[model samples]
Target chain A: MSPPLAPPGWSRWLVPPAALSVHLAIGQAYAWSVFKPPLEAALHLDGTQSALPFQLAIVMLGLSAAFGGTLVERKGPRWAMTVALVCFSSGFLISALGAWTEQYWLIVLGYGFVGGIGLGIGYISPVSTLIKWFPDRPGMATGIAIMGFGGGALIASPWSAQMLESFGADPTGIALAFLVHGLSYAVFMALGVFLVRVPRPADRAAAAGGPSAAEGVRVSARSAVRTPQFWCLWIVLCTNVTAGIGILEKAAPMITDFFADSSGPVSASAAAGFVALLSAANMAGRIGWSSTSDLIGRKNIYRVYLGVGALMYLTIALFGDSAKPLFVVCALVILSFYGGGFATIPAYLKDLFGTYQVGAIHGRLLTAWSTAGVLGPLIVNWIADRQEEAGRHGSSLYGLSFAIMIGLLVVGFVANEFVRPVHPRHHLPAPPKEAADVQRQQSA
Target chain B: MSSDSSPPRGTRNGLIAFAWVWVGAPLGYGLYELVRKATQLFTG
Candidate 1:
């Protein structure tokens, strides 16, 4: 379908904020860890029980994004963003009610299930529209929007912590925080809804003035799934994500273990500093590395992300805890690659499949993230817990996990090497029936 | 598309500035917190 075009003289630059508005708000999901202790204490729940909300939210994010991607593409960003705004805001409000009532299951149902759908839909809603707006610089364009997701936690973590502290950390306080979050995010995301516009057909045509790499292949999301390229990229994304998330999911405690026997053990506050640095690295890498892809090419950048990433893991495995500086540098670099892997993948899809259904394809691809999210932390935490049980201390606790991460990165690197352009056979064919209907309408 | 006309320089600059501010406001706050935390860890 010919999408509605932006008005003449509409600045393409305005679109990223619209995307950022939604991403930054939904990105609050990453900060769910901030609520764990408080929730556990207040609700008289265990660690696993408290974590169910976050875990279920993530699972729902992937599921909704995968299923609703086509809807985002079909209905346009306005429809997608509005749905996201409602689902996301209402989820928070519902969770607030659950909190007030002291119903843990309601909190789980509201935040995990309903809020997660918001995350999924909100995440992919602006992607395709941004690419369409910035055909000239798809990498940079997408990086700008997606970087907000990474940055979201940086904003929410401290803010949420402060709110919980000030509000008293009881059920009443928790409900208040949830209420504030829901209300504020609804206002924040509405900016995107109103500001976002599809490039007019004429503008789109004008924007594609010359034949370009993005015009090379046009694959629908369904067809993209059939291609080896898609699956290869999936493996590449999943493995890379798994490796990074492994360390990230356990950063604070892992650092303390690494330095437990050192001249001075790393303090809890210092470990928090380390985590904050990793978050900085993740956010910076999203923008910096993805923008670099615009210059170096997407496939080549993945080589750096996967190849050098594995080497970074190897460096840490060999010599990490010996020097705190070395350990920090390697960990920061690896985390950056993780963030870059996320920010770059949309542009990578644009490269291989054209813009036809890139958003849908990107949505479907997020299932890999959900998979890695589970697998990565499990591998790292499980091994770490076992090592602690067995009287292992210091770097040895994570040495084995780091080695496994390196192996995963190598697998990703190999998969990246195997990625070639999608075959022409997978490209979407023009539908004659739609063309005839349009022609008949025009004649009438 | 390369064929699309660029918006006026003043308008475009204004839009770019607005876009950056929109995304950068929260990011700047996050950075502030990170810096504050790091400072506390190192100096305090």
Candidate 2:
């Protein structure tokens, strides 16, 4: 169903919370790891087998967002949120069935494929609308919503762990946990579906008349992909994500490995704490740094994300495990930049291509994330594995991987430098009078 | 546009407050949980 246009004086402030509801629900995907060990034990599967659902979910997230983006833009946020709620909640229900029946493939099909589509659509659903509503502070507005996605795991992780602790991690308990998640999230996400409103044409026109309106080259998603600027952004996102996700994916193990020879080796619980700390940094960065981008400009902020991010890697590499506090601080800063990069990109796209099809454009850009999802873990894990085979231990095990990440950040830095405003040639022409009239009529 | 045709000022303010709280409470709980967990790194 198409969302109704906002009535006059409808507070734009209401939009972020509406956006957050869906984001917070879908963001539970990040906590998928909490289920991995239990799934492995229950199904008698290997680590790789247990990881399949999360991997496929990530892959599906990118593919569906890329394909369904135009549809989401066409249908509006209310419809998209409704669809996400249905898909996400049902996927969990289906997984519950699979767990109860001891069918691993069914769980994959349900959680990975169905739930992943929900993640994709839900992620971009409110982004363009937020940008439209808060023309003056697009970065901060979108950041607030996107931060919910990063922070979602903070809620889901502990909640899921507590549930498993209570439920015994057996198949019956797993099924019950999934059932609760599916039903509860359905109720929570319904709030967003009901609350979302598109800006009225009159309201948009009034906003456009203001100084900070995002008015410029109006590139369609179809045309945006053709521009050099888009590819540059693709590189920028991919590398930045790869660098941060590498450490993130390996955070616990990497920290333990780094400090193996120290005066006090990091215990498993402390390593878990480090991962939790990184999550905090990741969530905080999404809001804090993205709001900073609104003030400093998107391009300049990327310079910091890529440039200073590389320095953090260098510090970790040089100091190794000698200094625990230094290593932790550097890792926290790098994770923050990672979260900031995700939050700030929509505003960056708005600056370059305008908001005509920004959600769709943003959808296409997330293919970079999907690619990084694979590339990051592969680089870190493969290097660490080789180091182990070679009998290397302690901090030396990750030095080469750290160096490679520094190089990747440098590449992203160059890519950010290459970005420029989209050319006028790529801009969509103004709608003809008849078409405009018809649109106005439909909106009215 | 002026606030002329908008809902009553008190109604609008109340809705905004409710909406923020709806999302904020959960997020606050999550942050508190994370901070509690993160402290183990320093303490342990």
DockQ of each: 0.32, 0.44
If you assessed candidate 2 against the hidden native complex, which CAPRI class would it receive? acceptable
RMSD in Å for all candidates: 4.4, 3.4
Q: Candidates' lDDT values, in order?
A: 0.86, 0.89
Residue by residue across A257-340, what tens digits does model 2's lDDT show?
Answer: 988877889998899899999998998899999999989999999999999999999999998588899999999999999999
Question: What docking class should model 1 receive?
Answer: acceptable
Which segments of model 1 are wrong by more than 4 Å?
A1-4, A205-209, A430-444, B1-19
| True C-alpha contacts between chains kept, each model in order | 0.47, 0.61
Residue pairs with backbone atoms closer than 3 Å in model 2 (clashes): none
Candidate 2 lDDT over B1-44, as tens digits, reads: 12354566458788888888888888898999998989989886
